[model samples]
Target: MTGETIGSDSADDNDDTLAAAGEFAVIDRLVAGRTQADAVTLGPGDDAAVVTAADGRTVVSTDMLVQDRHFRLDWSTPHDIGRKAIAQNAADIEAMGGRPTAFVVAFGAPSDTSVSVAASVTDGLWDEARQLGASIAGGDLVSAPLWVISVTVLGDLGGREPVRRSGARAGDTVAVAGELGRSAAGYALLHRGIEGQAGFSELRQRHLTPQPPYGQGACAADAGATAMTDVSDGLLADLGHIATASGVGIDVDRRLLDGDRQAVAEAAAAVGADPWEWVLGGGEDHALAATFPGALPPGWRAVGRVLDGPPTVLVDGGAWAGNAGWQSFD
Candidate 1:
């Protein structure tokens, strides 16, 4: 708690910058208790803040995006990166059938970077925060070789139990509530130097700035979703998470993904790549996926069904033999 500023007290103007202040100094300045949402009992300075849930259940998830590994400064502005980072992390909370209440961020950047860039990044973070009526709450700063952003989100259950991935049973319908494959298509368009294409241009933008379906996760929960997850990884890979977590089998019908596949088909063809790979195997879409026992609520579309037997994810009643999506290590 030492050296942590009390209020809007701006520190001494120095060429020192973030690096000179050191990691802890910068973090102390950033997180020195301002105001917290009613949901957070303890804010920063602890190992982890204690977030209270109405039903005594806490929904938590973490995500890390490396500069080159997850984003490129050449393609995405700092603002876009900030929004995407927050949006994707919040989507994970939605997948658990909860609403994000607070977020704690850890950011690493080069010392020579301008303060304007960091301010733009903060603007993006706050911009996205207002979307869910949440606030930045607390954060940390550190010096690194390249930019690295990590966000941990805390969510409230609103008195409802968390919808875990291991609860989907056979006969449950598989559904999605957000766009799929757009980011991947956009990435392809950018990488291939496809210029002057309207659709590809939109796809490229989606790669830089993803649009997560806010509130849809809680909607699924209220509708009695048995299992759910966000498509941070490929559709199959993410569903595989629910399958293993819930001890159920998931089978995706490719035909059901007709809309998703077609949405990026042209870009795939232009890049001489299979659209199904993006549809079935591409990651970072952050779409909401869940198992519904009845008619899905508005903004959702059914794509498949839960299956009996082993915990696995299948495509068209068979195994999908494609690049199973990206991973930290090959």
Candidate 2:
């Protein structure tokens, strides 16, 4: 998830600031001309919104982003921040083998911020939601020192059991859906101020807004996924959670991930960094990783195998000595 805080200088005198528009007017602009998903029974304009849970249960998750902490306005636009906020939260639903149905967002920015910027953010939220056949049921706009966004996602399992992170067995194959290392590599490029490369811009955009494999979570579930999670953190760190939960060890073959390394090898070279580190330890790709007992499904490739041993993630049969993933504090 991500948030924003911006300077008022970006807004022209003709623009209506948040304080000038007032909270109600600003919120009206945010929710105007929006369509609700089928799951949403009632949308904004009421005291509360309602969404239907067809399977008799609802899957819910929430995440937040802060200025300078989760995002930098100078690097990303309000629209990018909005898309990222929705994508990351939706990933949590997908990781659990559910379909995202609706989202409720809360945004906080300086009173002097432009309403157009806020509307741009809402446009981003709705555009991304439309891709998954979801809706932005409702949200709140508030005054704050910086841009901060918090999103809550509601999902449906469609009568199937939810896939968790604790069902791996000794012989299960570990597989991943979607490409890896792109976002991390993008971050590296942006951080180092590298530009004008053929592929570096795409990498930087990936860092601004991730592209999670949307429907692969349900496909993995149907294909008999025993355990699952989205790779928001580094691959090794995320799999380590599965290892601990399932009481099994995971061994990844570096050769299996060479393709991902190659994808970012040029950018890594430009920055004088190791592409393998990004492939193994880079996080925020939002890719799906799961353990399956049967043939891998389409769009998923096997990267390793479950082992009968102490719970841990090993690289090429040994421990990894480099950074394993992102840490909120550090």
Candidate 3:
């Protein structure tokens, strides 16, 4: 009972690790003073939270980020990691043409982790959730050897059907709602230990925390998108999924992606890597890539076209012979 309190007003700063603060106190600190969105009828402090799904249907998705695998503590602050976790999960909901309503996070970190650090992470979770007009309804904290953050997001489809990967037809246009290759460019910069340049600094920050094109999924759906997905895996690899599912070929025009390539050209030069590789193969950008039947929606740029062929993703009608994407085992 003589442990350090975990709330924001706690006086003790030193020796304020999770073990020192205890579980219930830390949970209280994470939930304290937090406001839930209107969809969340009941929030933290109960066995479970209650969220409303107005359309009599709910879209749900889950993602897990492990330390060193999905993120690095040395490169990303606890706050950045929290934001990344929420953004990626929210992107999944967006891919389904839904708006995220609530999130339940389950976090595990070493007992020696500082309570202040945990609070910062929670703050980041709340911050990013607010961008989607959502809230963190509830979550769990547990002791582990390394950091593991898992998030489950509940989304509303707004009476629209969820866009499926199998819906892309041969003639549909492939459009993207957000920038690509920045995260990969940032990763290359971080990997090469290159810093100090103002532009490179921006790329590095992007690697730590992604800026997902929020609200575009619904827009794409409203614009008659036939198939949709988020660019979490490299663009080519993710598009390959739609190709495989829809039994169509995707031909990406490199010319159409020049802007993305140019955005990272300088950083690529500094790191001695090809900007095209990152633009085509880099992952974690979380940009929304959808196939539309007609003109693209606002904020979307045409990048490719669905083709009538075998299930494959082609760059300029040829296969790309570079590292195409992230693999959990590799």
Best-matching candidate per lDDT = 3
CA deviation > 4 Å runs, candidate 2: 1-13
Clashing pairs in 3: none
Global lDDT of each model?
Answer: 0.82, 0.91, 0.91
lDDT of 3 by residue, 1-330 (tens): 112222335455464788978999999988999888999999999999999999999999999999889998779977898999999999999999999999999998888777888988999999999999999999999988888899999999999999999999999999999989999999999988998579899988888899989999999999999999999989999999999999999999999999999999999999999998899999999999999999998899999999997999998989899978888787
lDDT of 3 at 240: 90
Candidate 1 per-residue lDDT, tens place, 1-330, comes to 122211122243442455555666655555444566776777777676766667777678889989878988778877888899899999989998889998888888886554445656766776787788776767777767788899988788788778888899889999999988998899988887887468888898888878889999899999999999998888888899888988888889888899998989889888999999998777787899999999899999988999895999888888888977777786
Model 1, TM vs. native: 0.86
Regions of candidate 3 where Cα sits further than 4 Å from its true position: 1-15
lDDT of 1 at 230: 90
Deviation of model 3 at 73, angstroms: 0.8
Worst 10 residues of 3 by lDDT: 1-10
Order of models, best TM-score first: 2, 3, 1
How many backbone clashes does every candidate have?
Answer: 2, 2, 0
lDDT of 1: 0.82
- Tens digits of per-residue lDDT for model 2 on 1-330? 222324455545566888989999888878877878999999999988999999999999999999888888889988999999999999999999999999999998888778888888899899899999999998888988888999999999988899999999999999999878999999889888999577899989998999999999999988899999999988999999999999999999889999999999999999999998899999888999999999999999999999997999999999999889988887
